[model samples]
Target: MPALNAEKAIAQEKAIIINTESLNVRNGPGLSFSVAKQVHKGDEFQVVSSENDWYEIKLNSSKTGWVANWLVTLKAGSSAKKGTVTEDGLRVRDGAGTNYSVVAALNNGEEVSITEEQGNWYKISAGSIAGWVHKDYIAGDAPETEDSETVSNVQPDNWTGISTDNSLNVRNSPGLHGSIIGKLNKGDKVSVTGSVSGWFRIEFGGIEGWVSSQYIEKPSSASKPPANQVSYGKVIINSLNIRENANLNGKVVGSVKQGEVYEILEEKNNWYKLSLKGGKTGWAAGWYMEKTVAEKPQKQQSTRKAEEVQILYNGTNLRSSAFTNSAIVARASSGETFPIKKKTGEWYEVSLKNGQTGFVASWIVSVSGSSDSAPVNKPKSGGLKGKTILIDPGHGGRDSGTIGYRGTFEKDLTLSTSQILYDLLKKAGADVILTRNDDSYSSLNTRVALAHYHDSDAFISIHYDSISDSSVKGYTAYYYHQYQKELSQTVLGSLVKSLSSRNRGLKQGDYFVIRENKQPAVLLELGYLSNPSEEALTRTHSFQDMAARSIYNGLDEYFSE
Candidate 1:
């Protein structure tokens, strides 16, 4: 059945803008040559190309630009087809709306510019940031044009890969629970062919295997790995004083000392087994220093610049080939280092310092963002500042605490609200502590461990209220021991005072994070997830600010007392 809606019916007769203000350019679809100027909201234009969500269009007297598919309503007697923009931005392809190109986002309440006319598409300018939109999403207008272009003429040379935090399963076969040959990290590039049940078969390191296409970038034929070539890579240690051994183990094989150079040979597991000066071989774990984890160190046999790359996370699988379809060579974790042998589009063929070679996902590991990326390493803070408090976001990754209404995951909201609190506290000048930084799940013990590690003056865990009802509201605060009564009271009082919701008040509750911590600890349930309105509001920045400010002010009052 045809996808239909209110917007479609209205667009059939209108000429308007979508994703207003997009600058069309010559690079990609939305980035083609800039033609016309900005089309204000509710303005009309003539469309030239009508592909997917993008309408290659020109204003009646204006040049041409692309507009998003969502921003327009139809004008009576307009010759544009009918369509509606979904909640999320839709894709806009080139040619005859066949093979889809990358997606162009069209936010709510935005207008699309129209250029040319097609059966259901109006080519228009989406603005300088994002380009065009299809006419199908335009409400109240319609126009008809020829299906003139083919996909072959406008396809891109390279396919972009997105980052996936989780370690992806690489299988020898293409089915569920297929033999787990190895695993791939986020950003690893692959050459795609036939897909089996949503699974994509990719070519990596000369081997072919299947991986879920959902996590990484889509495979395209235009992007292919280069032929085998040697490349050189250097080892980078986070701690400047990494110790070297005579052998693979820390057997004091005579310390090469930090910053000493060694010849590359082989990479295994997370260790770079190196060839020392006297023909002796010694091994160092990749974690000891930031070194590349895939492929053999590129010997100078081939000339290639040393590429600075970081491991995305711990335990990324290294493949013998550039595609996930290749054979498994080794495994690497975050902070490991390596050199690039060659790059095929987005995937880089990398060699470990110790000489092992393989393919690793590029997006999972940041090529530029380093742990030391922040300038002037601030001394890890001591206790939450008396003025600003840091709220540690808890249970990211696999450590989701409890499930709430409509499957509102706890980890998502905890981190979400904590981030809000962190920003508010920091802006307000209170020193804060974040137990864990990213979504990688941390243990409960780690929560208190961070507080003790930083000697935080006070500790607080932010959570959402969850009861059987799908429509309950209010906020609550919990403390495990009596010693934390003052801290809890201050936070609770401020929260109750600031928020426009029911006050569940302070209660005695034993939580592992509070029970095990040395400093004053409090856990807050700021609102009920079961209530639809409250749940939605809790997800927004405004409500979070209210909570953060309330907590901050509460801390101020408590410390003063």
Candidate 2:
């Protein structure tokens, strides 16, 4: 099983070749899976890619299967020593140094058969996927396989662990912001089904939930928090109070907003003691902070010059391949800059600081704003500070809104979009209140009432439009009062620029939230769920993130003005 300290990965996947006789190729990705075929150590196959410690080789035009990269080796080259990959997301450069281009990436515990060595680079190869990895990150060797029977039986067992701390929270999802669903007491036995981002999924009391791997004890994963080892935590909520104590009534020492980070000094009773400036410390609620879990040594900012092109907003998708439908390599955060390597019709190939390349949409890069291509790092808290933004997800419960061309519920989409918007706004330093954070329903009156009661600076009613004509696909903003016209136009302007959607234009419409509310308000029909293509696009994580970011950017502009 993978360790908790490792960076966010499904699992590690790197290896080198061997010259052993008659090696078994697995039908599946792991050793425990059935063998598909046998090949000599030097037998070559068309190498496509690697994932989760397995090499994908094309058997024929239509057929493909996984093989252990450990069993395959280069026919001519002989290895000096077998090594282990020490870091997650370690660059496999074309040469040994940072100047070299990244040919591939290695994850923690991956096999590293060093064929040759020069300075800091080692010639590591497993068939077609061959490159030089840094020597400092190559550990001694992967565990030697003594026998076939023993190797075939190697698989991770489901974790049976005892809770080491009192009241270990089990969340609905992996991260700290995932709502708390239950708790486990000290010494209680629990079984782990999975792990992601340093959190373990376990089944308890008829609920499958996740808990921090830190407070749980499994013989293999059992370890205590290191002394003087600090973790960087990004604020997950808008404007969290940094207090003098761990309790609610503690004196407010300082304030931090979304996109802000601090070094954690200690953790107690669901609160984090933060290392503030001038060597002082302050306590903040842990539930509003997301801890970084990077096992690799942190890469420093590039001393090289900046690129001309930069992402205008956060949640921008970075594709791994040239093809438009390729796998998402990563998500670029706002204000995080990258030098443009080149540009095609629709995509911008950007060189990341990690020495790897990724493609982003040109439309996103071209959307110049007040902070367009800002600095490469995430920006400090901005216009969202002290702003009370009410987000009303349009429909819920029995009110499913319009049915999409793909049968997607409009209520579900609204809720999903609003939830993401809430996070972004909170992180940006807004006191964001969601009318319905879950599947529950809220009457229009209640939603409007909530905004008025909070004395909200701005109110946004999020919905998706539908039409009988499937050809019609676009986003629109509506305002019921003259006061909301500017808000509607500003937000819709941002949506049109940042997203690849048609602008249906802002219209004066009698929407209850906008008409009845005294605050500056707008109702956004983000997209036409009835359009098959647009419906499919709206459901993606990338699109949802982009939509939320666009709206947040619009609000930021409104508040700044």
- How do the predictions measure up, each by TM-score? 0.35, 0.34
Error of 1 at 431 (Å): 2.4
- Candidate 2 lDDT at 264 equals 68
**Candidate 1: worst-modelled 10 consecutive residues by lDDT:** 142-151
Cα lDDT tens digits for candidate 1, 1-561 = 112122322223335443333322221122112334555654665445544344555555545455544344334354323333422454555532333364456653344555454434444445563334544344323222111222223322323343253346655544432444445543333445445444556543345555655676754547643322111112322222222542244554544332233433543332345655556766654333322122222122223244556563468788877676888888887456677666665466788766777787654443432232211212323433553344766456544444444334566667757766777667656777776554555555456555654556678888776654555689988887777777898889898778998998888774556755556779888887667678767766578778877887777676665
Off by over 4 Å in 2: 1-382
Best-fitting candidate, measured by lDDT?
A: 2
At residue 331, give the lDDT of candidate 2: 87
